[model samples]
Target: MLQLEQFEVRERKLQFIKEYDVEKIHQAKLIVDTDISSSVSLIELAHMVGLNDFKLKKGFKEIYGTTVYNYLYELRMQEAKKRLLNSSQPYYLMI
Candidate 1:
C-alpha cells in the first residue's frame, strides 16, 4: 500500500509537469534568446523557469524541434554573421 501511494504521488507530479510544459518551454526559449552569449546550464535554466531538468530538455525539443544548446548556438552564429557582414569593425574587436 505504501509503494502504491508513492507511485501515485509520482504520477501526479509528472502530470502537473506535463500540464505546464508548454508555458515552461516558452519561458525557456525567451531565457535562451535573452542571453545567447551567456553560458547557462540546463539546471540553471530549469530552475529559473520552474521546471525539472528532464522535462525542460524533453519539452524544449518537442516544442522547438531542437535542443536548447543547439538553438542558442545557431542564434549566436547567425547574429555573429550578421554583425560581421554589416559592420566595418575589426573581427578581433567583435570577439
Candidate 2:
C-alpha cells in the first residue's frame, strides 16, 4: 500500500507538467539531434520552442536525464568516433 501511494504521488507530479512542456522538450531534442552543426544559443533554442531558458533546462534534464550541454557533447563525441571508424582513408593519411 505504501509503494502504491508513492507511485501515485509521482504520477501526480508528472501530470502537473503541461503537455506543451513535453512537446517543447521533444522539439529541442529533435533540433539538436538532426542538426548537429547548428550553433544556436540556448536562449534562442528555448525561444524557438516557446519556453524560457530555465524551464527548458529543467524540463530537458528531467526528460533526458542529462543537461543539454552534456547531451550535445556526448552526441558530438559519438559522431567523431563514428567518422573515425568509418572513414574511407587511413587515419594517418588524413592527418
Candidate 3:
C-alpha cells in the first residue's frame, strides 16, 4: 500500500523533470544535485516515468541517445572525476 503511493509521487516528479528538459549536458549538474529520492523511484526510472519498462527503455535510447541508467552512471563518474582531479593529494601520494 505504501509502495503504491510512493510510485504515484515518483511519477509526478519524473513528469515534471521530463517536461522541463533542456540541454542535459549543462543541466546534468542540476539533475545530479536535485533531491529526486523523495519523488522518483531510483530503483526503476521507467516506472516512475509512467511507461512500460521496455518502451521507456527504448524511447530514452532513441530520444536521449543513451539509457537512463547509463546517463546517471556517467553523471556520477563525472562528479567523481571532478573531485579527484581538482583535489590536492596527500604529500606521500603526490611524491
Candidate 4:
C-alpha cells in the first residue's frame, strides 16, 4: 500500500510537469508567431515565458517538431512568398 501511494504521487508529479511543459510551449509559439521580425534570443524568450532555456528548447521542439529559429524562419519565408505572389507593391518595397 505504501508503494502504491508513492507511485501515485510520482504519477501526479509527472502529469503536472507534462501540463506545465505544454503551456510553456504554447506560450513560446505564440510569442514567435506574434513577432517573427523581432530578434529575440532563446534565453530571452524562455525568461519571458517562465521556462529555463534547456526545457524551453526541448519542449518547443517536442511540441512543434522544429526548433524555434527554424519555425520563425519558415513562417517569415512563407509570408514573404505569399506577399510576393499576391501583392501589387514593388518587390523592393516588399522586402
Candidate 5:
C-alpha cells in the first residue's frame, strides 16, 4: 500500500546503502593491503560516503544496528584477529 514516489525514494535509498556497503568493503581491503593506519576519521568517512556528519552517523546506525565508529572498530578488530591467527604475530598483540 505504498505510494509510487515513496517506493521510488526507498529504492533509491537502498541503492545508496548498497553502494555504501561496497565502498566500505573496498576501504577495508585497502586497510588490509596497505600500511595505512587503521584509524579512520569520522567526518572524513562520512564525507566519502556522501553524507553529512550527523546524518551519516545516525543513518548508518539505523541501517546497520550499530554506531559508525563501533562498526569500524569491530571491523578493524576482526582484521587484526585474522592477521594474528594467520601470521606469526605475538598473541599479546591480538589482545
Candidate 6:
C-alpha cells in the first residue's frame, strides 16, 4: 500500500537522525575529555555537537551510564590528583 511505503520511508529517516545524534553524543564526550582543563557547560557541549541539551543528556547517559557533569567532575578530580602528585612531589612520596 502507498501508506505503508510512506511510513517505512519516514521510519528510515528517523533512524538516520537517531544514528547521527548518537555520533554527536560520542563526539561531545570526546570534546570534554580532550579539553578537560576548560570549563564547558551542558548547553555549550550540545551546541558544539549539533544536538539539543535534552537529547545530549539523554543519549550521553544512556551510552556512558552517567551524567555529563559527573563524568567531567570525575575526570577533573583524577587529573588534579595526577598533576598534584607528579609535579613537585618526590617519586617515593607519591607512592
What TM-score, over all chains together, does every model reach?
0.75, 0.78, 0.47, 0.76, 0.53, 0.71
Measured on C-alpha atoms, candidate 4 has an lDDT of: 0.84
User: lDDT, candidate 5, residue 93?
Assistant: 68
lDDT of 6 by residue, 1-95 (tens): 99788767666545645788979999999999999878878999999999999999887776676899999999989987887766876656654
Off by over 4 Å in 6: 1-17, 89-95
Error of 2 at 32 (Å): 0.5
Off by over 4 Å in 2: 1-13, 90-95
Q: Per-model C-alpha lDDT, please?
A: 0.84, 0.85, 0.52, 0.84, 0.60, 0.84
Q: Please write out the lDDT profile of model 5 over residues 10-78, one tens digit for every residue.
A: 566656555666455445334433533445676776665565667666556544556666766777678
Candidate 5 global lDDT: 0.60
Better of 2 and 5 by TM-score: 2
The model with the greater TM-score, 1 or 2, is 2
Model 6's C-alpha root-mean-square deviation from the true structure amounts to 9.9
Error of 3 at 42 (Å): 7.4
Superposed by TM-score, candidate 1 places the C-alpha of residue 6 at a distance from the truth, in angstroms, of: 37
| TM-score: model 5 vs. ground truth | 0.53
Q: Best candidate, TM-score-wise?
A: 2
Cα-based lDDT at residue 78, candidate 1 = 97
Kindly report which residue stretches of model 4 are placed more than 4 angstroms away from their true locations once superposed.
Answer: 1-17
In candidate 3, which residue ranges exceed 4 Å CA deviation? Answer: 1-43, 89-95
lDDT of 2 by residue, 1-95 (tens): 99788767666665767888989989999999998878888999999899999988988876676888899989988988898899998878865
User: In model 5, what is the error at residue 91, expressed in angstroms?
Assistant: 3.5
Clashing pairs in 5: none
Itemize residue pairs with steric clashes in candidate 3. 10-39
Q: Per-residue alpha-carbon lDDT of model 1 for 1-95, expressed as tens digits?
A: 99788767666555555667779889989988888888989999999999889989887776666899899989999998999999999999987
How good is model 6 by TM-score? 0.71
